[model samples]
Target: MFSLSSSADAQVEPFKGERIDPDVTSGHLNHLTPDQQAAFNVFKDTLAKAQLYSPERPHPTHDEPTLLRFLRARRFDPQKAYKQFADAEAWRKKHNVDALYATFPVDEFERARRFYPRWTGRRDKNGLPVYVYRIASLSGPLQKELNTIPPERRYQRIVALYETMTRFVLRLCTHLPHRTEPTPISSVTTIIDLDQVSLPTLWQLRSHLQEASALATANYPETLSTIAVVNSPSFFPTVWSWIKPWFDEGTRRKVHVLGKDPGPTLRTLIDPKDLPKPYGGELDWKFEDEPALDDAAKAVISEMPKGPVVFENGEVRRPTPPDPADVSSGES
Candidate 1:
């Protein structure tokens, strides 16, 4: 239902789109409108009645930032926010989300991950994880590899990727020294390149895309900071129409179809060092490349307490610190 512009001629012109605001922090609550604050308060008050309590914690365990996220997603409607919040909690339980992440095999995790968007182990200007998905990468050997895997395995891997984003990626962002913000980094920026999209290509990846869209909408609402559809073909308008319905309005508003030339706009949103070189950024990486967690990020994960990323109640959980001294004094 939406196109970048009204005029046909201007539609294909590549340009940076709307600005995506940063995540809300506890310190930022004073800036919220009266009604918005009230809605968040009410959402918190009703948590007990909702019975969305986490197993590891005594009461419902949502943080202030988490509370605001649900309320904002529903436009400050406390009741609506409460419903989705409860629903997501139930979804997590049904999917065994915590245990899945704790136990998913490493090799399968890495292989299945490549089919989804690649997180560049980088963050955008606002300190959000950045993901690059190249449509062209779907063809050839990758397509054959993807086909060999069972649908359920692929689905679980996608879930794990999101789990890592919440449990690992966002957690690492909170420690980046360059970012001088109190707010926790809660969302991500995605650039989906449609360089050689065609009817057959669309048909091939339709199911996976739809499932991923539905997953994001249902359980990860309000976690998208930006989505740039770049290197789009001339017939992108028609393609957009077909793809548009997959996302809800809140997410769609954040999308910008930046035709053939996306370099300029991408650089504006992301520093060149953080972005992949292909898109006029300084990072020496590409979409097909499997991202390596840099040492700093790895250290953050290693020392983390190690607990379920999120409770069944939709509350974020931080891991405890590592224990030292495995050394035994007496023997061998």
Candidate 2:
């Protein structure tokens, strides 16, 4: 019963329902780059197809409440997401992308000397850098002195130097591991017990001390002292493991005079001349008196609390009765 004009009118009404300006409809895309715009166009096409074909709720009909809520629920806060992506990219550029040192090798010293001689300048006759020449030039005597320093010691020194320089380089180059950041120990405490440290930790401590000593010798030669502390006999094995490779036979024997038998008691050894003058009054090898273990035992027993008497069958009991015959004999 419907006329063809009525059907055409209904189609025209839907088609011409409303017309928004393209600029107004696509205002959000104004801030996006060309690449982002291309991506958004594809996304729009996909969204349109999804709305046309899918049974799920179609794209939001309104901008303010419905569209904003949908975008928010989907975590589509474009500004925040962009900012986080930018920060991650910057961090990767700064630190994570850089080349890292593969390993600290003893031979690196010679390589460094060859490649960057100016950084490792040769000393002159009076042990000063040859400032006039750019390249390091070692005198015959200085080269001989370096060569004579026994292979093992040379390696240790070289490895120690390489570690120091590498640390300097890492601090200089990287932003990660946050160099200026403070740790709990830095704020609250300074001194640490060496006894609680592991072998690698002890090695690091030793290397640090060696670096300090070297720096002191370079800058404040007069105050430099060749002193070391051996806190316990147990640490000797680890110390010798690192030190023995660097020393000649004579130096090794002199340094490790303990030989096959480490002394029974804990002993401190120091170069006599290096000792403070007050303590150098006399060589006291003899003990004035032996330790009285009986007195020490008595002191310990006197401080002990009286405990309850216990019977053999695991029952608590009163003090056992003394012999009545012995008591009568004592009275007689």
Candidate 3:
């Protein structure tokens, strides 16, 4: 159990609450003590022996940070980490992650966004990107459209969306500049707003939630640093009880559920100025084509590869990413 300090009260928190030194990249075992580093090597060797080969391409090389993520996720157990690593690699191969990344459905993504806005816009206090989701707003016509789809097709689409979103995040993090040196951003702070959630909506979306949770823990590993579920309705506890078993201890500990007012809790991790207005912040912004964001926020937004945006009313459009070479040169 790591000691995490809540910035709000400066109180010692439970779980793996150790501060990730801003200089440290996610999973960089070099920061570990000699014994831990040695153990990580053995984990890698053991992982190589596992049948985690990919037909799509060569298996990704296990870097220190990446290996360390798996090790830490499984509590530094080399055997367990190797199994988890292999399972994730296998899942990637089965899902064809490369193809999904290359051919993302911009239109479908926009529709989904309109139905349920998901985006990473502003940086939290720690300089890490914040991925926000408003599930309560995911009702109405968008839900109807989803309902029309066949079960298998719906499952496939959800998987694709998850993969695309994950890919987009990976790209954004890849381009993000280090805060100082050797600390490339690798994780995101998540906010799931549940202000107006209903039982019907929750029940309908249960599978999606479960799949997403499983994917995050089993596949994505330690990509989520902090999670805040704001505006939880009265039924949230009952819902959480049913879903709690799905989340690993690490993931569960990171999640903080807010009853109604999320301002105080959010302020602990983010500045009011940086947060969007819908969630009790000063910034006025919408998940639309043109957002009411300030200059600093706009500057950060410019770094992202622009994609299609769908309004609340049914409409479709697309925007293209800048040239990869151009993006690369700009980042450099």
Q: Please name the candidate that would achieve the greatest lDDT relative to the true structure.
A: 1
Ranking by TM-score: 1, 3, 2
Model 2 steric clash pairs: 152-245, 152-246, 153-246
- lDDT (Cα atoms) of all candidates against the true structure: 0.66, 0.26, 0.56
Per-residue lDDT tens digits for candidate 1, residues 88-166, read 8778766766567766776677676667777887778877778888878888898888888788877777787787776
Model 2 misplaced stretches (Cα beyond 4 Å): 1-198, 209-229, 256-332
lDDT of 2 at 315: 27
Tens digit per residue, CA lDDT, model 2, 2-58: 000111112211122121111111212224456545544443444445341122345
- The true-versus-predicted C-alpha distance at residue 36 of model 1, in Å, is 1.8
By TM-score, the better pick of 1 and 2 is 1
Ranking by lDDT: 1, 3, 2
lDDT of 1 at 209: 81
